[model samples]
Target: MRSQFLIGSRAPSIEMLTWICGKPVFALQRGTIYIVALFSTICPHCPKTIADLGQLHEKYGDTGVVAFGVAAMERAATADEAGARVDTWLNKELPNPTISIAFEHTGEMNKLWWVASGSYGVPTIFIVDRDNSIAYIGYPDTEDPALLERVLTKVMDGSWDNSAEAKKAHEKWLQGALVRRANVALSIKDFKTALSTIEELNEAIPDNPQFREAHIKVLLEMMHDFEAGWIVLAGLARDAIEKNDGDWLLAAMQQLFGSPYDYSCLPSAERFSMGKVLSERILTLCPQQDGISRAISYGAVARYFYESGEINRAVDSIEHALELVEGESLPDGEKQNYLAPLVQALAEYKGSEIPREFAEDPQNRS
Candidate 1:
């Protein structure tokens, strides 16, 4: 199903019920590159994505490039009705869009392009080369977000390598679809599906450690498979420890100590052993005298130490974090986001009431 729409495959035809602006395009024009932005009228925020296309249209229109914004997965009853609604909506959303747009009430365009390519959702973008081949298809703002711009420039300059481009685009394509599917599944509390999909995604994109953590999250927090999740996460923590990967180690520790998930379910021996390793690793990797990076790391490790009954270590860590927050590296105004949370943690660690001096919420302060 997806092979036919892979990079370098002939792009599907532009078939919409109503063409909003520019000459109605039914066939690919020779020697002209095309950029199509797919958006959903049903999505309140999809209008924002059109502006990105509009900017590009104005930027590249003179250079033999054409851009289109097609409304897909609309909620309106008829094609004409959807077209009319979209015209009014675009006028309201973008004020004056330079690119051509079309409306789709039937799901044919989505099925033909989005589903056929295994890409999902609105704001998905496609760049078609002059030869009418599907040069790229996936969400624009992701995994090497500059990929669209890079691919567009390469294709326009007659230097696109399908094998190299597809390697990047295809991975993001699978990731985007699986992420959407995982979200949909999680919304319905279909933990089984969410776990499997995230696991598949994690395996497919090993460079992204967050996906691996997400897989563990779904396993332990959503599916309540504590032992299974711990096994996977512990391996990551061990690797992070060995490699001096502070960021990955921090994420692993947060999964153990941070909330919305019940940490009590974690086995006692495994919990502290992991926390001890992570906390010690973080101490070495994130020196206390640095910027927001250290401040964040210190704050997280503080919680682990505080819970481990090392009150002095926890207090010192939080204090250093608080001091780092006030450093010149962080703007006085921007400090509140970190300050508010750290202040609360400080009061809790000290087993005292939060003083009125620091009682105000950062959000309210702003």
Candidate 2:
């Protein structure tokens, strides 16, 4: 099913049934305008947005503005599962009446609200009029009191034109829907769907640099198709080098070692060569005298050796990096941060011999 939602069109009536203080409430009533915030309970940014919606609900509930939060738990299947997620979130930290409208979707409400309500990112806010037409779509961060007031005023008076600007806004919102679907697919390791979504988006928005570049990274990580990913990275790197863009170099390095996926599969020799080049370039740019940069460079080197099956070298490199962190005159939390994982990995491996410095005692501080 196509998940794209367009604004300035008929808003689908989604049944929102969730609980508050053990009492269930229905979200839709025939004559009331509703502002809904679609969110995920686990999303790091969702709570703050939910808090803002609570404030809006508190101020507007009696007069006509009704706000609700809709969330679909990651593994939710039945109404019971959805309700359990809501209950858990409420029990822990997020408890708001606005969260009372979440329920499991059977695809009916998913199609209706996912796009029109700007569900691309959690904390997406939608202002729907009494007629169920979306009147405003935006992020809470971008929303102003005046904007909310104007929408509410128009919806209450029944005089909104649903302006030309709303149509344009809806189109822009729909474009975000495609990207959002691609991101969710990538998150779940659904490579083919993610690639297809990005490819279509790339075709539709040829001039957009952000879309093209993001798709390239998504293709590499999600598909595990490094050859194509590397080719684009190399091309982009070369272009950036010609332009002397340090930002692009950092971005290229990030794509190389940023994830848990294997770049070492490129061939030990190639991995070592690429690592050496990038490490030298990064050090020349930032020089790891401090804990953070040192840790980052150290991580790149350690990964390079580990991927190449040079466990001894990896151990030595990590030790040296940890030593640098420990030797710092100032206290930097990353020293312990970087060393703890390296120590754990080195300690756990039965096949590889730990380095001399770490072998004497596994708990030895760097």
Per-model TM-score, in order, reads 0.70, 0.47
Candidate no. 1 TM-score: 0.70
Tens-digit lDDT track of model 2 for 64-147: 767767774335677676667767886676654543456554545555666445465666777777776666676654545455
> Can you write out model 1's per-residue Cα lDDT over 127-211, one digit (the tens) per residue?
8889888777867564465667777888888777555766776786777777888898999999998888887887777767688
The true-versus-predicted C-alpha distance at residue 166 of model 1, in Å, is 5.4
Q: Which candidate leads the pack in lDDT?
A: 1
Q: Clash pairs of candidate 2?
A: none
Global local distance difference test of model 1: 0.78
Query: How many clashes show up in model 1?
Result: 0
Deviating ranges (above 4 Å) for candidate 2 = 1-110, 115-124, 128-189, 198-227, 239-251, 254-277, 287-290, 301-320, 328-336, 340-352, 355-366
Scored against the true structure, residue 215 in model 2 reaches a CA lDDT of 66
